[model samples]
Target: MRLTILALDDVFDTGLTVLLDTFSTANELAAAQGNPVAPFDVRVVGLGRQVRTALGFAAPVEPVDAVRKADWVVVPALNAKLPHLLLKALERTDVIEAVGYLRAWHAAGIGVAGACIGTFLLAEAGLLNGLEATTTWALAPLFRQRYPDVRLDDTRMIAACGQVVTAGAAMGHLDLALWLMRQKSPELAAFVARFMLIDKRPSQARYIVPDYLAHADPLIERFERWARSHLADGFSLQEAAKALSVTPRTLQRRAEAVLGKSPLAFFQDLRIERVQHLISLGEDLERIAGQVGYADSATLRNLLKRRLGRGVRELRAELQ
Candidate 1:
């Protein structure tokens, strides 16, 4: 397959390298296995003839202007991990050009994929609008605020809407590469993954820090503080709104806008976080359940399973 790996200036060092390594490894493995699948025709294309990575190393790259055709265009994350920095980076002339090129490529039926903040580039191109996508979980609130038309599912490790693919966070670069390889040949993807000791991470939920996400909005921050303080008590929308000095409607609206969840759902998230913390302390299921305002251990256990897709025992084992 012809793959164009688009390299933005000051791109995330690991994100770019991991894609190179993964695809190169897949080619080696395929050759060794003597399979019918041919090696990938990969080119790391830049806005210019060369690109500088976040780590200050200059990478040689083919100019995007010289590209004739490609089957897929892969975008690796840039170095701007914070919202403010990313917003600024997106406005740079080079990035603007990259976005334009991405739009043209996709218009020509080339598959597109991005990971971490690179997903923002795709969204900036209006490619992810009205489609389900995933990005780094911590920046999900900012992503939602920027691209309200996009259905942002921050919980997923990889979200694919047709040929447009997005993956989560720093290590999600590997996941994105594997996903593209899987599209070409599932068996090849599996073989490359096993040789690299890469395991499937289906959801980004476990890695999320709810408080960090809440910090995006002042009201949500206050609401999160209230929720944490009242974990042992039953959630009351009226009471929470009263405590935050906002009406229930405003509280619900802000929560949904910034966190993409209702107040009660975020409360459940806080409760689940508390349950995990208490579990790490070796607390019994009954005690943990009571601490998180659950009526019984079974209720908490089921909630944990439903939300995180892991049982208490499994979570505890992971903590160990």
Candidate 2:
């Protein structure tokens, strides 16, 4: 694979190094094993010979022109606070040029892969439209708003839309690299995994706090605040709509458009999240179940199972 890594100012250093080191290890392992396992020609390229990172360090790389001859192009995650990072990234002349470069390279049949906030770059270029992709879970609201045409599923750690792949938050780079390596040689991918002590992680939902993305929009924000207050007891969609001075349909629309959950289900998710938090503090399951309006631990267990695909024991461990 002729892999070219696109480095930009304020790049997520950890994600960048993960790809570089992993692929370097892959090449070394392939050479040691020989024959069937082919080496990955990983080239790190920046706007210039060097690009500044958010961590106060500078990364030196080949010029961007190197991507012209590459078979795969990689975009590393952004390192700064997301609000600032997105604004700054979209404003850069370098990003503008890179978007064009990506459109051209991908049209020429080169695979494009992005990790975390780096997926936003692909979204900005309109390359991910109508494709299933994942970005940092916390940034899903922004991604959805910016690229509504793209199918955004942040629950999965990696989403492959043909030759373009988008990965979830920060450490997702490891998963993305492993997936790419596996595509090349599953045997070599296994060998590399053992060497790196990395395991496959397929979901980001457990780590996501429910209703967290709701604050991105005013309508969603208002609903979230009201819902959180009423989670101690159950509330109806009509009551919530009346309280918010909107019709039930309006609340439904806002809930679906902003958070992608029905109002009743969203309310239940908030309750579940509250239970998880209590468990993280070592609260008793029976006690939490009652507080959240569930009759007993059995009912709570069913709720967790229905929404999160796990029981209280596993969900507690995940949140903690």
Winning candidate number (lDDT): 1
How would you encode candidate 2's per-residue C-alpha lDDT over 65-124 as one tens digit per residue? 888788789999877545656877787898888888888888888899999989988988
Worst 10 residues of 1 by lDDT: 63-72
Candidate 1 per-residue lDDT over residues 1-320, each given as its tens digit: 78889998899999999999999999989989886666688899997878999999999999885445788899999999888999999999999999998898888888999999999999999999999999999899999999999999998999998879999999999999999898889999999999999989999988899999999999999999999999999899999999999999999999998888899999998888888888898999998888888789988878988988889879989988
Worst 10 residues of 2 by lDDT: 80-89
Please estimate how well model 1 matches the true structure, expressed as its whole-model Cα lDDT.
Answer: 0.91
Estimate every model's Cα lDDT from 0 to 1.
0.91, 0.85
Runs with alpha carbons beyond 4 Å of true place in candidate 1: none
TM-scores of the candidates are 0.97, 0.91
In candidate 1 the C-alpha lDDT for residue 179 amounts to: 91
